[model samples]
Target: MNLLRSQLGRPSRRWAAIGIASAAVAGLVVSLSGCSSSTTPKAPENTVAQGQWPSYYPSDYGTIVDGAKKEGGELTIYSNTDQENWAPIFRDFQKKYPFVTKISANNLDSDEVFQRQLSESATGNAPADLLATNAVQAWATYNNEPGRVMEYQSPELAKMPDFAQVMPNVYAISMDPVGLAYNAKLLGGEPTSIADLAALVSADPAKFKNKITTRDVSGSFGFTVSKGFVDGNTDAWASLEKILPSARPETSSGTQIEKITSGEYLAGFFISSAVAFPAQDKAQGIFKFVFPKDGTVVLGRGIGITPKAPHANTAKLFIDFLLSEEGQNAVSEGGLTAYRDSVKPAPGRHTYGEIVDQAGESAVIRVPYKITSDADVKAFTDKWNGMLGK
Candidate 1:
C-alpha cells in the first residue's frame, strides 16, 4: 500500500512493487504471483444492475482471460498510476492471465500518454496497448485524433452512470475528487466554498502571499479542473483569479502537499482529496482536507484501448479485469476513490457515492472538457499567466 505521491497537471508515475503475499490459513492460501493462460471453466454470464452490484460482474471472465492468453502479446499500459499503488491491480491481473508473460506498465500524465500514442501513430507504430488517464483531460488533449485512441464499447459501460462514460473507449475507472488541503494551524479556519476561499486570501494577501499553492491553468489537469469550477459557479473565475496575486503556482500535488505539511504554505485548491488524504495519514501531519461546499471537481481516471494495440485481445481482457469486482477491490486498497457506488474503497477512503451523498449531486461536478479549441486553451493560459506576470 505504499505510494510515491506526485502532483497532478503534469506527467508522473514512480515504480513501487506490490507484494501480494499468500495467506497462512490452512484452508485459504491465495497467491498473487503467477497466473495461467490455459483455458479454464467458462465464467458466469455477467449482468450488473445499476446501484445493485458492488463491482463489474463479468459473466464470461474465464473466456476473456483465455482468449487474451491466445493473443499472447505483452499488454503495454501508459497510466497515471505509480508502480507501488498499481502493483496490486497488476498483480491480480497477472494472477488471472499468467500466460500473457508480461504487463508492461509505464506511468505518465494524461497529456504525455496521449502524446506518446499520437507520436507512435505518426511513426507507423503502436507501442502502447492501453491508456489509463483523466478522461476529461484526455478528451481535450487527444481531441480524438485519428488512430490515437480506439473506440471499443465495454459492456461495463452500461453499468456506469452516463456522466462517467464520456466516450465509448475513454471511461472512468476511478474518481479523483478535487478538494481543499490546508494546514489546520495556518488557515484561521477552513473555507467551505470558493467564495470563502477568495475572502480568506483577499482579506490578508500578506499572510497567504506566496503561501497559497495553485496550478497554472495551461496543463491538462489544471485546465480540466478549472473548466469545471468556472462552469459550476458564477463567482469561481474571479475567486480563482483573486488568489493568483498571493499564490505560488505548483505543477505537482505532492509538492503542494509537502509545502503545506512543512508549514511553508497554508493551503492549496483542488488537491485530489483521495490522493492527499492518504499521504497525510502516512505523514502523520496536521494536513486536513474538505470538499468545497459550492462545488468540487471530480476528475475521472479513465482507461482506453489503444488503436493499434499489439495485443488487442489482451487489452480487452485487461479492460474487463479493471472494471471487474476484484479490480475494484484492488483500486480501493491501492488508495483512491472507487468509481462505483457498490465499491467499498479502502475503509477510510470515501466512495463516489459517499461523497455525492454528503455533498449533494450538484456539488460534484465533472471537469468540463468538451470544449477543446486552441483559442480556448490560449485564453485560459493567457488569463492565468497574465495574473502571475508569466
Candidate 2:
C-alpha cells in the first residue's frame, strides 16, 4: 500500500478519501459522511490475547496487540503540554485498564523539561515512563543521547499514515497548524491578512499597545512565529514585525492566548488551531483566527516510551491506547488534532484551512518544517529575540 502524505495548509478530505479507498479494495467503494479512520471497524473482539500477538505486526504499528488486558501499573510522564486537556482521555483509558494503580502527569515548560530530563538522566534517576513533548526538543533529546527511548511498536500506530510516525521511537500524535488569533469584539472585524492586522497594531500603539501578546522566544509558539517570519514573503514579515513593539511575551501559549481573550492583549502573534479557536468558541462574543495566505506552520506533538521506563509494559500499553480509534476520538473531542486524514477540527476549534480560505490570496506564506533541530532552532530564536530586545 502506498503511504499517503498529510495535507496541512489545505483541507483535503484525506480521512474520508482513504476510507473510500479501503472500501474499494474490499469491493465496496462509496462516499460517506463523517466516515473516517475513527469509524473503521475494530479487530474481532475476542480474537487474540495481549501476550500472544506478533512483534512489529503492522507496517506502521497497527497490529502489536490484538487486544490489551485490563491491567494497570504506576507510570510517571513528563510532558510540556497541558495534562488537564488530556485528563479525560486518561480517565476513559482507566475504564479499559482498571488495574492502573498510580499515574503521575505534570505539565512543565518545554525548556525546563529538556533541562531537567537531561540533568536527571545524567544521574541514575529516570523520572519518567512516557515522554510527550514538542517534536524538536523530543528529537533533540533522543538523538543527542542514543538509546534513551525504547522501541516498542504498537499495533494502533499502523493505522496512521507515514507522516504520523516520523520515527520508529517517536509517535507524532497531534498536529497544530498555528497562526495569529485575534479578539473579534475588539477588532470590530477580522483583518484580511496577518500583515494587515500587524500594520493596524503598529499604527495605533496607544490603542493596541501591550494588547498584542506572543509567546516567549524560548517556547514552541515563539518558534512557530519565528519560522513564519522566516518562511513568509517580504510584506508578511514587514507587517509582522510592525507590531513587535506593542507585544508582551509569555512563557506559555495558553497564557498568551488567555491574555488576548481577556482583552489584556488584543491578539496573539502565533496561535495553534487547536488551542486558539476552541477557546474562542466558548467565549461570550465573536473571536477570530487568521492563517494568512502565506503557508502556516504545522507543529506536531510526539508521544513515546522513555528509555529507562520502569513501567515499560504499561507505557507501551498507554501508547497503544492513544493510537487506537477510541483514543483518537477523545483527542478530536478535545480539539487538538490537525491531521486531515484522521480526526478534524471540532465545532469550536476553527481549522487552518478555514482561516486561509477567508484570507484568499492576501495571506501568502510557506508551511515550514525542519525547525526541529537544536542548532537551527537556537539560531532562529536568537534572531527572533533580538528583534524584540529580549
Candidate 3:
C-alpha cells in the first residue's frame, strides 16, 4: 500500500454533484432574496422579531425563521459528538429562537449516525432533521445518493472561508485539530511532536510499552485523522514505526483521555482537541495536549440538513445559526475549535486561526472532504494495521 497514492485527490462524485447544484442555488438565492414575486414564500404575520441579526443577511432570511416556528418548533439531530458538547450550542440556539420548543440530539459513533439515518429513511420513518460527523468518507458515500442531503445554501456562506463549505449544503461545524496528549504528572518532559514522542519512547521502551495510545484506525474518525497526519507529513510514518510498537490503539477518545488522566496510559497521539480540551478541567492538570510542531491535522466536523428532514425549515435555521458568529462562539465554548474569524478567543478555547498561527500555515494539514475508494481504504487500512502488528 502506497501512502503517496492516498493523498487528497480529485473531489468525489458527491462533491461534484453538490458543487454543480450549489452554483445553481447561488444564482437562484440572489434572485429570490427580497423578491415580492408571488412564487416567493412570505414570512408569516406572527413571525418572531429578528433581533440583532447581522446586516449581511438577506432581507428575506426571516421567512425561514418564520417557517421554522410553524413547523412544530422542534428539531432532531443525529451526530457523532457528545451531548455535553452540543449543550452550549443548543442552549444558545433556543435562546435566539424561543419558538423552538424541543430539540432531540443524539451522540453516536461516527458510522452509526449514517447507518441509522439510512435505515430510518428507508423504512419510511422520520429521520434526523440534520446530520453531523467528522467521517468525510462516510458522508461522501451517504451523499452519493440523490436527496440524501438538502441542497439549500446558507445566508452566512459569504462570511465563511472556502473550506467551511465542504459541499453544497454541507458545512463544517467545527475545525478540530488533532494532536498529542499526555499525563502531565507521569511524563517528565513535554513532547512537542510525534518524532519527539518517538525519541522519548526509544529512550525507555519498557516505560512506554502498552502505555502510549492512539485511535484504532479501523474506525472512520481514527482512519481519517491518522491518514491525514501521514499524508501531510510522510515523516510521521517513520516516527510512528518507532512508536507503534509501544502503543495501544483504542476505539474512542474518551477511553484514551480517561486512562491517560488515571495514569493507565502515559500519552496518546492524534487525539482530538474537541474531546481533550473539555476534559482538562476534570483532569485537574493531569492531562495536557500539544499541537504537533511537525504538522497538525485540522479536521472539520461536517454537518448538513437531510433532504427528508421532518422539520426542514428548522434544520435550515440551525445550519445557518451554526455558521453565524455567535453560534461559532458557542461551539468554541463547547470545546470544539470554532473556524469563523469573527469569533473572539476565549481562555483555553481554540480557533482555527490560533492553530494556524501557532503551527505555522504550512504546518496545518487540512483533511480534505473527498470520497476514498473502497480499494484505497482497504489498502491503507491493511498497511496501517500491519504497522500496529494487528
Candidate 4:
C-alpha cells in the first residue's frame, strides 16, 4: 500500500476548511480587543513553584537523575517551539552538565519534524537525537510508525502517576487543558462551564455570536472532538459546532487568549487554562478560564527519543533529566503539574481531567501503544475536511 498517498488521501481542501475559519478568528480578536478598556498586564517568570510536580513515571530503581556518573556527547533536536522559549531550557540542561558540548537545535512545526524524521529513517541518516511535541501529534506518529521511537522507559517512568503513564514512547513532562476563556470585564467573569457559556452565547447571539475563537485542531483537536462525539457525549460535537458559524479557529490557544485579554474576542474555545490563566493573571486583558460543568480537553506536551538519534546516550540522559523533578518543574513553570497525584491547577475555568476528556485521553480510549496507522492518519485528515465542507 502507498503509505504517503494514504496519509495524503484526505482532501487537502478539508485541511483548508480550518484556514477559512482562522481569518474570522483573527478578526474577532482584533475587533473585541478594540472594545475593551483594560490594559495589558505583565507576564510571569518561567520557573514553576515548589513541590508542585510529583513524578510523571514510576521510580522503580529509586532516582533517575543519575548525575553522579558523568557522561558526555553532542546532541541535537528539531521542534516547533521557537528557539527563544526552548533556549532557556537548553541552557539549564547545559548548566547541569558543563561537560557536554556541540548541542544543536532546530525550530520547525511538529509536522515538519515528523516528516524529517521519516525522511532520515528512509535514508539511514536520522540526524536529531530527540523528538518532542504535543502528545496528540507524537502519539499519532508513534502509532503510525511503531518502533520509530526508541523506548528507554526511564527509571523515573515508574514514578509517573498512572494517568500520566498511560502510554509508552511518549512521556509527558508538562500538560495544558482545553476550556473556555473570556474577558472578565466583558462577561462579568469566565462562564462556569462550556455548556453554560454556550447557552449564554445562544441566548444572546448578538453578544457572542461571532466573538469566540479556537485553535486549528485539524490533526489532533479534530481527532479529539471526533472521539468526544463517539463517547456518551454524542451531542458534544453538535453542541460545540452549534456555535461554529460564530466561532473562529485560529493558529493557537495562546493567540486567542491574547485576543480575549485584549477584548478582541470575548470568548475562545479549544483553549486551556494553562495558557489563559497566566495571561489573565498577568492582567493581559481582564480574562479568566473556566470549564464547562460537563468537561473539556486536556492536551500534554512531552519529549521522545528518536529511534536513530546520533547521540543515543546523551538523548537518553536528557529524557531522564526532563522526567526528573527538576526538569518537570521547569516545564510546568509553577503552574499545574502533569505528574500523578501532583497538585492540580488552582480553581479556574477548567481541570486537567476536562481536557483529557475532550482530547479523548481518558480511561476509555487507549492511547495506542504505538502511533496511528498510515491509513488511519489519512482517514482523520479526510474526515476533518468532510466536516469543514471542503
- Give the per-residue Cα lDDT of candidate 2 at 265: 72
39: Cα error in model 2, Å: 27
**TM-score for model 4?**
0.68
Q: Which stretches of candidate 2 lie over 4 Å from their true place?
A: 1-72, 114-123, 199-210, 218-221, 232-236, 262-264, 273-275, 338-340, 344-383
- What is candidate 1's lDDT per residue for 298-340, written digit by digit as tens? 8777777877787887887667666666566565545556676
Q: Kindly indicate the candidate among 3 and 4 with the higher lDDT.
A: 3
Best-fitting candidate, scored by TM-score: 3
Candidate 1: clashing pairs of residues: 7-252, 7-253, 16-84, 35-98, 44-59, 45-59, 46-59
List model 4 lDDT by residue over 114-218, tens digit each. Answer: 777888788888877877655464456554656877877776667665545435666765555556678878964447555666677777777775687755545
- The residue-by-residue lDDT of candidate 3 on 313-378, one tens digit each, is 989888888898878876776668899998756564568988877778888899988787778778
In TM-score terms, candidate 2 sits at 0.68
Show model 1 residue runs off by greater than 4 Å. Answer: 1-63, 141-143, 283-285, 388-390
Instruction: List the candidate numbers ranked by TM-score, top first.
Output: 3, 1, 2, 4
Residue 210 displacement (Å), model 1: 2.5
**Model 3 off-target regions past 4 Å?**
1-52, 282-285
Comparing candidate 2 with candidate 3, which one achieves the higher TM-score?
3
lDDT tens per residue, model 2, 205-284: 68877777766656554655556556666655576567766777676556666777777877875665655654554555
TM-score, each model?
Answer: 0.79, 0.68, 0.82, 0.68
